[model samples]
Target: MYNNASVNKVFLMGYVAREPRIHNSKNGKPQLSFSLTTTESIKTQGGDIQHSEVHAIKINADAACLKDVNLKKGDMLYVQGRLQTHAFVDEQLIKRYKTEIVAIGVELFDPIQL
Candidate 1:
């Protein structure tokens, strides 16, 4: 028996829901976080249905990547990264879990016309 499989990648293309929240990490690394919304329509027994999914993205990149690009709400983007899950305890001492896309690359598209 032979096993050879290794892949951890995610690709998403969607519109930015809001402006990115920029901040610095403890080690002084630049970080950008934003919400992306992807929508799709599916055929079901009832009828055609529209569905939308929002993904939280966090980008840890160099200063150039975060400073040179002007990111804004409603901007279309293509992101490639890996999925990451974080577990922490809230103020109430309850455990919480969150899944987010840790973006390695981001490409900004032209503004979407309505």
Candidate 2:
């Protein structure tokens, strides 16, 4: 029996780390790939320090979507999507895993000063 009680959603708001890459899917649809850097501040005896993490994002849509939104590097971006993990075997027959967000919606906002 299945209860269907599992959720794997993710929401990320951060600065684009680099230019997004566009690729063609097997069916010829466009796929956009990019990474965003999110920061967290930790309070310590030496005062607050910032730590950042980069997340890989993938958007499956038309290339025109990029132009319509004018998405580019250094822009503040908000993404709504789900987390996915990919598994593969390396040349050495070792198994590797990667995790990424498959974006369902994306939006741009003015840069927020940290």
Candidate 3:
């Protein structure tokens, strides 16, 4: 009988679309941002169709952690994180919202393994 309403967790396993961008937050904390691409094959009445989706990921960590990971383009990564929505005003003074995955843990596998 324990039901928690606040549940926001996400797990994604895919290829890195590009090199991760490293930047510092307003509080001087190191942050990383990247795009992950996931693909799936769907079978319809006609035939199988391949579909792909890209996700924006953000990670808040220290410089040492960033240096250790060294994520690169085309690398396979497994990310465990939570969904976060950010609202901000664009240059045109229009309100915009973006949802991204705030990674709590990330794992990198060598290309040779698979």
TM-score of each: 0.84, 0.83, 0.86
Give per-residue CA lDDT, model 2, range 1-81, as digits (tens): 669778889999999999988888668888989999999999999999999999999888663345578778999988889
RMSD (Å) of each candidate, 1 decimal: 2.6, 2.9, 2.0
lDDT of 3 at 25: 75
**On residues 5-111, what C-alpha lDDT tens digit does candidate 3 reach at each position?**
57789999999998898898778888899999999999999999999999999898663345477788999999899998989999999999999998988889786
Q: Write the per-residue lDDT of candidate 1 for residues 38-67, one digit (tens) a residue.
A: 989999999999999999999985644455
lDDT of each: 0.86, 0.86, 0.88
Top candidate, metric lDDT: 3
Q: Which 10 consecutive residues of model 1 have the lowest summed lDDT? A: 60-69
**Model 3 weakest 10-residue run by lDDT:** 61-70
Angstrom error of the Cα, residue 45, model 2: value is 3.5
- Residue 66 lDDT (model 3): 52
